[model samples]
Target: MDAIFIQILNGLDKGGAYALIALGLTLVFGTLGVVNFAHGALFMLGAFCAVTTQKLLTISKHVQDTSITFFDAYKDQPYLEIWWGDFGRTIIDWSVPLSILLTIPAMLLIGLSMERGLIRHFYKRSHAEQILMTFGLAIVLQEIIRSIFGANPIPTPAPDIIAGSAPIGALFGLDEALVYPWWRLIYLLFSIITVSGVFAFLQLTTFGMVVRAGMHDRETVGLLGINVERRFTVVFGLAAVVTGLAGAMYAPILSPDYHMGMDFLVLSFIVVVVGGMGSLRGAVAAGFLLGLLQSFASMNEVKTIIPGIDQIIIYLVAVVIILVRPRGLMGRKGVMED
Candidate 1:
């Protein structure tokens, strides 16, 4: 029972990431009608934002260790530690969260630039062209990141205060052995809040209503004098910010690497498709569903019986879902119909 519960938590943790990424992808597709392969690059960039924040905070001077008389050894002592002492150290420790401030503006600008300078040009083009162009852009972004940050994965850890496991079992009156990581729980909550916020903004606000209308009939919204194209440009930027926050928060879970974005890109795309091309609710639902299935499939008992089911469960489920319901579990009719 404890093991099962643990897997459930694990599933939710993974699902949060999948759902966040898929949500942003769906937003861009629904609003701009553009298939953006570079969305993952934005995620990678966000993770790097956290990395850069840590680096900047820890800018250090080499200090000679006089105790090591045999060989001259120099320790890198951070400027923060030297300047403000413990307070500076605390700031350094909170670099991942602090980077959120930097990520918002940076990602927004990047999204706007991509849309205004490049994506806008291809709005009327074929899906294949968009895919090729965006894929090329993704590669270019990847290479640039690699050149700057190198090829290795950089570790970004959660703050010490919440780095340990939580006694979730006690809260639920279950076995105390059923503890979960504090950061994972925080991430799950974060995902829920972000998803809810997006939904609320879209459903309750005038700007969101116009954007929603634009998604249905862009020409009609234009005729209504709403500047639908401009609204969509902002939508693209919002998507970037959402994806960026996901990546920034996720840095502690998965080490930030130049290729990490590409790694999640394919799975996220599958998630978007399985959820329904333009359905936000479907995307969120499918993400958690697949995440749970993947976690359960990874259990020793299941893997022993099926041998490598864990590795293929998601794809297999996707195939089945596509075959069974062409429009997906929650997709509307004629979403992708020609």
Candidate 2:
């Protein structure tokens, strides 16, 4: 029972990230009528932001023990360390958390630029073309990131206070049975809050209403005298920010690497599909549901029957759901077509 709960928790976190990424994808697809293959790359960019900030924090102008022959050979001074001073110390200490703020505007700009410069060209093209071009864009983005950040996984440490495991067993009246990591718990709460906030914004705001209106009928919205293009652009940017934020928060748990975006991309696509494409509520439901399902798949007994169940659970669920309901749990037909 205890083991089962642990797996469920694990799945939820993974699923949460998947769901968030997928939600963004679905929003753009349903609203803008473009298949955004670069969504994953945007997510990758977000992780890179965290990694970049982390790197910036630790880099220094002060040379490390130059007594080492390696430093002598490289002749590299830790110039940034000296250049940054206490500012660097503060950054090193708080960059991971602070990165969320920095990545938002950056991601938004990238999202808008990509939409206007790259994706906008394909808006009038067939779905197949959109997929191909966007997929190509994703590849390009990955290559660019790899070229810049290298192909290594950069370690992203959680803030000091949230670094270790916390005892939750006592709260459950079972000592020594239910410990959880503070970071994991914080992430879970963060996911819930973000998901809720997004849903609320869509449900409550007139601007969100305009975006939703544009999604359903871009022509109609345009005819209604609203600038559909501007709204869609913002929506595209919003989608990027949503996925980027998820990626940023996720960096600590999963080491941020150039390929991490590609790694999570498939699962997120599956989650979006399962959640019914454009349904906001469905996306939230499916994200948590899939996360829980993934968690359970990793349990000892479950894995005993099928080793590495976690690896296949998501694809399996996607297959099963698609076969059962081609449109998804709450999908609306033609939402992806403008």
Q: What TM-score, computed on C-alpha atoms, does each candidate reach?
A: 0.96, 0.90
lDDT of 1 at 208: 93
Cα-based lDDT at residue 268, candidate 2? 76
Model 2 lDDT tens row, 1-338: 66666677777766677778888998888887787777888989998888887776666543446567654433434444467766655557677788887889989999999888988788889989999998888999999999998898888888776787877767666657688888887787787788878778777999889887876777888998998888788889988988998888888888878877776777778888888877776777788888888778767677899999878887898888888776778787754322
Candidate 2 ranges with C-alpha deviation above 4 Å: 63-90, 333-338
Error of 1 at 34 (Å): 0.7
What is the lDDT of every predicted structure here? 0.91, 0.80
